[model samples]
Target: MTEGTSNDSTSDHLSNNGRSCCNKESTNSNILDAVQTSIDSLANKEWSNVESRVLVVYTGGTIGMVRNNRGALEPKPRDLERRLRGYPHMHDEDLAKEKYPNSPFLVLPLYKEKHCIIYMIHEYSPLLDSSNMTCDNWATIAKDIRSVYKMFDGFVVLQGTDTLAYTASALSFMLENLGKPVVITGSQIPIFETRSDGRDNFVGSIIMAG
Candidate 1:
C-alpha cells in the first residue's frame, strides 16, 4: 500500500496492489483513470501561472532495483534514471532542455498535452535497502526536502515497500504546515520487470504531485 497526504479527501492518496498478473492493458486503463480522476478533482482548484515542479526524493527501493551479474535484484546507483529514461511514459527530453549538472536530480516532464507536471528525481547515492531505514534516514529525507521547500510545488518520496508506511508517517509529522501533496510509494517488484507495478505507481505519483 502507498499513502499520500494533502488537504483534499484522504481517499485521493490511497493505492494498493492486489494479487494478480500484470496486464498491461488493464494497467494502462487504470493509469488513465487515475489521471482523469486527478484532473477532474482539480477542475475547480486554483493553480499558479508558473510551471509546476515536484521534488521526488527516491531513497532506494525495489522500484529502482536492477539485476546483478548473479541475477539477483539489488540497488544500483544511477540505474533508476537510466531505466526511467528508457520508458517513454516517464521522461520527456524537450521539456527538460535545461539541466543542472551539479545536482543529483533528474527533471521529468509528464502529460505534455495539458496540466503538465515537471518533476525532479533526487536519487540517493549508495542506495540503502529498506531494512537499513532508521530515524536518521528519515531525518535526512525530511531535511533534504526542507532544504528545497521553496523551489517545488509538491513532493514525492519513493522507497521500498518494506518500510514505506513508516517513512510516510514520519514525513507527515516532519513537515509542519505542509500545504502541498506528499506521496510515499514503492513497488513489490523491480521496475525493470515487464509485469512490475512501478510504472503506474510512478506516473500516479506525478499526477498527484502536480
Candidate 2:
C-alpha cells in the first residue's frame, strides 16, 4: 500500500511538471505571434499617404547669412529659400512641379519612409543677428507660431547661433500649452558655404519638426 501511494504521488508530480512546460511553450508562441503581426503590419503600412507640413521661421541666423559688398555676413531675405530650392536633398523640383505648382513651399525627396515633408519659409523682416535677439523678438516669434498653430504640423526656427539657446528657452516660456514641436537651430558656418554644418542641422531639424 505504501509503495502504491509513493508511485501515484510521483506520477502526479510528473504530470504537473509536463503541464507547466506546455503552458510555458504556449505563452512563448503567443508572444512570437504577436510580435510577428506587429512587424507585418508596419511593413505593409502605406507611408506615402502621410504628409508633414512644417513652418520654417527664418529669424536671420548664420545659416542664412551671405557675404555683402564689404565681405561681412548679413542676412538676405528670400536667399535661403532660393538656395534650398537648388539643393537636391532639401527640395525636389520635379515633385514640386508635378504636385505643388502653385505653392511656394518646397518638397523634401522621398527617403526611408517615403513620407512627404512640405515646408514653407517665413522670413523675418530685417533679420537681426543672434546677439540682437530681444524679448520683443521672442514675443513676435511666439505670436507667429500662435497665429498659424492649426495650419502646420510643426515649426522650425532658424536663428543665429549666438543667442539660439536663449531664444529657445524664452520661447518655451512664452508659448503656453504648445502641443506641436518647435525646433530652434543654427550653424556656426553659413549654409551658403561649401563645407557647412547647416545642411545637416537644417535637414535634421525639419525631420524632427515633422
The candidate maximizing TM-score is 2
How well does each candidate superpose onto the true structure, as a TM-score?
0.69, 0.73
Q: How close is candidate 2 to the true structure, as a TM-score?
A: 0.73
Model 1: residues with Cα > 4 Å off, grouped in runs: 1-50, 94-113
Q: Report the number of the highest-lDDT candidate.
A: 2
Q: What are the per-model numbers of colliding residue pairs?
A: 0, 0
Candidate 2 local distance difference test against the native: 0.69
Model 1 residue 207 CA deviation (Å) reads 1.3
lDDT of 2 by residue, 24-95 (tens): 311112323332332233322322333787878887878988889999977788688888898888999998
lDDT of 1 by residue, 1-210 (tens): 232344432222221111111222111123233323433433233224335767677789998888899999888886676777667668765544433222223445545566566555676765768877876677666656544555667778889998888887766656545567778889988777889898889888877887
- Lowest-scoring 10 consecutive residues by lDDT in candidate 1? 13-22
Error of 1 at 147 (Å): 0.5
